[model samples]
Target: MTTGDRCEMPPIPLRSTPIKGFILDITGVLYNSMEGTDGIPIQGSAHAVNRLYSESRVRFLSNESTGTVGHVVGKLGRLGYTGIREEDVITPAPTAAEYCKRNGLRPHLLVHPGIRSVFDGLSQEDPNCVLIGDAEHAFTFKAINTAFRHLMKMKDPLLLSLGCGKFYQRTDGPCIDVGAFAEALKYSSGCRHVVIGKPRGDYFQTALDSMGLAKDEVVMIGDDIVSDVGGAMAFGMRAIQVRTGKWRSEWESHEIKPTLIADDLLSAVKACID
Candidate 1:
């Protein structure tokens, strides 16, 4: 279907922020569970992102920390998104790495072994901070307690969370995410954390910096109003909420509303560009 065939909502008159490019969320907005459905093109929902990219650079920002940038690029390519590159993708792990590098703060990282190899020039002793992201073993109380105890001793140690949902919905049921673990640490250790994903301004800041745009010119699109809309609005960017993935009937009652809402990505894009 063409752009006209898709949009169900009228595009609001945007005041125009410095967001000449776009910063996109991956999980619910791009793909679900990092897997591609049969016959579904990666580009299927990417029309608006591509349209903006044609005129401006589009960065495929994600919070997945389980794998390296190559893993993310491969997944996107398999889903039919051809524009993503290694540098375009950002995750909490990498963001933490960069933050450490720039600030000259080396922290002991607790990442999944798969992506642990990506950390360079860091060691286990006397680290400046404790960086936590997604880990296959992260759910265990033993793991959490161990990390928490170490954090308690550090002076002003910061917990950095890559984009992880507070709860994840799967075939079996809902489950806690690394953020909950981080929260537990906060409660116990009394150390503050900086989240680097949806619902947090830090993640948006990273995306905006990557896109080289101020908050106003960029548009935030996602399937979840809480993360996508709320997060984007917190950063002063226009937001479009898509009624897919995490969309439910009660979202209309939310205290914070999107600039516009649509049935799907196509409609959301139309609402933005039209």
Candidate 2:
């Protein structure tokens, strides 16, 4: 879909802030968890993302733990987003795997079954590290207690969190993410988690490093104020908040102001481009 084909929305006041690169959140900004690839695209999201790709470096940064990098790229293509590759996307799975390999730590992965492929070669037997992601069906009380028990026995065990997002938007409503579970484990085990996703410096740094651009030259567009806007702004990147998915009126009262507020992703891109 092209920009001209989109139904008109109210104009958002443009910002003069120069943006050389873009870090876009996948679930709430470009798509939601309702129908996966068959899900409805946020209006003009595909168009905006395509346009931005044509103009500058754009990275699909998502905290979603449902799929591997390849799966995410395929899903985007199936949903009409073009020109995205494995390298164009960043998620906590691969990042966590790399960290584990670098430190020679065994991972006790507590992620969704769909995304476990990211840690195919990692050690799971008598793991010395605990890595948590949105485990969906696997996040039962038994699982949490088992992970907590494992952490208690290890010496300085590593606790890695892919995302600390409180909730994600779904077709039905907001669904709890792995962040709540991760926190529970942290509280019980008394191990400080190394958060590798949004609202953390490492997550922003990974995206910034991929673009090879200064933080000041990049803009993050997302729906969550705390994770997307506040996180990016804290990392020195300008942020644009979109009133879609999990956005709330109460976010405006927060101290972390976005560079611009738009009705949707298309408007956010227009502010950056036009």
Q: In model 2, which residue pairs have backbone atoms overlapping below 3 Å? A: none
Off by over 4 Å in 1: 1-19, 34-43, 46-49, 168-175, 200-202
Model 1 C-alpha lDDT per residue in residues 1-274, reported as the tens digit of each score: 1233544342334444344666666665665552223224323576655775676666665666777888777877877777767788877677677777777766666667757766776565777677777775655777777777778878877777666466543323444566666777788888878776677787787777877777777877776666678777777778876766566668765666677777766676665565
Off by over 4 Å in 2: 1-17, 35-37
lDDT of 2 by residue, 76-162 (tens): 888888678889899888888898889888988888998888898888888998999999878988888888988999888568888
User: For each candidate, what is the lDDT?
Assistant: 0.67, 0.83
TM-score for each prediction?
0.81, 0.90
- Best-performing candidate as measured by lDDT: 2
Error of 2 at 254 (Å): 2.2
